[model samples]
Target: MSGSPALFDAHLHLRDARILPFHARYVKDALDVGVTACIDCATRPEEWAMEVSSSLAATTAYGLHPWYASVSVPNWLERLECVLASDPNAPVGEIGLDGIRRVHDGGTAQRAVLFAQLDLAARLGRPVILHGARVWPLLLRLLEPWADRICAWQLHGINFSHELLALPFFKRANAWFSVGGGLLKPAARLLPELLPHLPLNRLLVETDSPDRFPIGGDPLVLGQHQLLYNQPGNLRCILRAAATLRALPVDELAEQTAQNARDFLAAR
Candidate 1:
């Protein structure tokens, strides 16, 4: 990793309960491989507190993910606002619409929670890390109104759509697209096509670790369960794949995307 450019994992979940016990090893492994920083996207209130209190050397994002929408505490919104208010640099997310899963009200609860979080992001002028699965059109429609108010946002683990890049958010340069292990899948077709179209300055890379384990990815061994989990150290592999897909030098793409992550986190 000596000659490799330092990498930033724009999205991950270091505070996740399953990974929390092995966080130290996870961070060390990533650092040893040149992944110096990351954005910890906490999907629930407890994870948010953990991220804020931990010494992970990464930017922290606080939000309520769609999966936990119905189960979230009544004061979750207030708690989220307090966390964001406490750290101005912190973004609001790992939040958005998920069409595939069945939640409390057949998606109605998910929409309501998403709208609240979006409104909060808009009011605070915070950047957001978004997740939309099988519902890009609906997510885009819901996001359109708040696009002008929120300073910046990233679509994490996004699937490709021709209309995606054409949105006002992209045109205004307020949006970013993050890709991860999904790129390593031999069956992945849309992302490869989406890569060339993404602006270098607006592109980002992430692991979304503990999930979406890249095909052929180097797995982090979890001793207790003997489970293979993705870790930030694997960022280098994702970067290499992205560079090849975009026809850019690995170092060049690495440097640019690292800077992109910085700019996005620092965006007002």
Candidate 2:
């Protein structure tokens, strides 16, 4: 193994069947590029089994994503607890409220599920992975009661304003912000601006691969002509963009974020 700290992907959905065929390739690419750790977060029931079975060489978190807050069956919470209990290292997450995607009473269901997971995380003293889309204000408010209870939190694919970073929860709850390929876009407002403000120790990075496929983001697809998905290897682009915004050397940022990710998992 290399002496330098390994690169870390703070969040992604590697267990998704869409990327199953590329598993070996993804692992090789991640290793070749020095990315040694990742948190593969599962959103709902379908991914739970895959998330458990996959030998992806990464930590995993299972939770009901906000999009499925209303749809996920009542038994999910019990199942999630069972999974988390099975792996001492598994954390609770990818759980939070969404404002943009409208479902029947989505906001209400979102809050209910979020609080349940938060309660579970607190009881278990496990770290949490949170997702917020346009619902920052409410999410922050909801987090207040559980802030002291959470062991640690990673705001995945975070794109919030700098002003929001000043909130006491960031400090009190021990939060880390994850930046992904979204930062590569020139039009992205929050990430580029927030990069400089992130405490080096609290800064984390991810590809959110197979999702946020930005311009020039990676994978040397040989036969296929069309762009279909993303790989964890594309994290190079995200790290480069973040390094540029933070005015830090690539290696330095990589090491810092890797250490941060380890600490995040260790917090559990």
Quick one: best lDDT, which candidate?
Answer: 1
How much is the lDDT of residue 228 in candidate 1?
83
- Evaluated against the true structure, the overall lDDT of model 1 is 0.85
- Candidate 2's residue-wise lDDT over 5-73, tens digit each? 577888988776777676766677677777777899888878876733433468888888998887848
Q: What's the lDDT for residue 245 in model 2?
A: 85
- The backbone clash count of each candidate, in order, is 0, 0
Predictions in order: lDDT: 0.85, 0.81
lDDT of 2 at 40: 92
TM-scores for all candidates: the values are 0.93, 0.92
Please list all clashing residue pairs in model 2, or write none if there are none. Answer: none
Alpha-carbon deviation at 44 in model 1, angstroms? 0.8
lDDT at 110 for candidate 2?
A: 82
